[model samples]
Target: MKPGRPRMKNDEKQNLLSAGDNRHRRTEQEEDEELLSESTKTTNVCVRFDDSPSGLGKTLQTISLLGYMKHYRNIPGPHMVLVPKSTLYNWMNEFKRWVPSLRAVCLIGSREQRNALIRDVLLPGEWDVCVTSYEMLIIEKAVFKKFNWRYLVIDEAHRIKNEKSKLSEIVREFKTTNRLLLTGTPLQNNLHELWALLNFLLPDVFNSSEDFDSWFDTNNCLGDTKLVERLHTVLRPFLLRRIKADVEKSLLPKKEIKMYVGLSKMQREW
Candidate 1:
């Protein structure tokens, strides 16, 4: 594996990943470091991993590493991590487990409590990372948009697939130099959804959804295997997708079994 940035201290690197019972597998470590490096190079990144073999824990650790790298480089931060309400605490726990040295504050609880956090902790930049829910983001957009964030990491990023949803609109307003999107399911239903992600990531390159759709349509009609290759080439730099079957040899492939049964005459009558 390529070495991590030289500025990263040995202890910091160790802290960036889990140890003990929660230690990352070899592949996980490689992915985490590679992603950390990629974040520096790309403005937007989409990391897609299968739910079975890939753990959000590893992804969260990678995010912590990114925050640390930014701090080390003297970049402005107080990075924002927006996740679903259900995963708010999980993200906090992941940070504590993987990179306890980095201070993280979860903007949850009552309105007054959240407001107090914003006033006392967030505005002053007392924390290295801020973990909030999409709901909270909309409710507190005024406060969040004011900050010049170094990195904005969105978990379950498919939440913004609509591109016009209130949550998506509000998040897009947050001024950040870099963005990272994490999702187990990246493209759910249509190509437009994929376009939504790309537009969010590289607005300059993918400025118009109509243009993106037209390019695909034109290529698909003249396809002689070139369409698939062209799509892959475009996505290669900004997207990373991995499934259990491809990465984990120990995992057994899923199997299906069929059985035939006859219903009783009484059951049929009923």
Candidate 2:
């Protein structure tokens, strides 16, 4: 929808998308061009906060996330928003109203387009950003396997809160340089439940659930801030956390809330 993004014909996009019969080529330049066009723009992050379940929490958290991403750090790869089927477009609308410069691709496609796009990202600096549902990622496994991800932002990441689930296994399978898990509820089930999510973000940050549990038990009822901050060693490579009170006290006063739902694009240079 933004200017300069090349438009493609429906039949052409459809034909390219429907490559059930032909596997020899990408079917069109725009398909490949979109990937190169997107990955080059901006790094996106997966974000979460402690108070996210409160009113205005999701929006405020997402707003803070955009600000933190833009001003505090510019991670080197495009972000992929992985959420439930319901939350995918909520993410799209947030990006639309908040960070208009970002370009996004919904991982929704005919079997062919999804596979082709993933192959395209194998080249460095392709697709400024991509968003996909957890189901879609599993569906597009062949494509997802082809490239190394600059960052993987798992929204409602609790979907893989269990380390052994097939979804969690698939997420761990990707070659990701950075990882962020976003969820409102941090201590779901118990502190031990947090381990699987943290482990995916930083392998063995706790080493074992019992290890953190023991440390918490021994330290006068205080958990290991040292082990938590020790996360800096691995997590700094992947995570950033901020609270809404950190910024936007004024902009958030009764902001209008609307949800725009759609599976969505790519754009140009800096």
The TM-score leader among the candidates is 1
Tens-digit lDDT track for model 2 on 35-83? 5565666443445454433345554454445445544455323555677
lDDT for each candidate structure: 0.69, 0.59
TM-score of each: 0.70, 0.54
> Which TM-score value belongs to model 1?
0.70
Lowest lDDT sum, 10 consecutive residues, model 1, at 1-10
Clashes of 1: 0
Per-residue C-alpha lDDT of model 1 across residues 116-173, encoded as one tens digit per residue: 9877787666667788998888888888766656578888889999989988777776
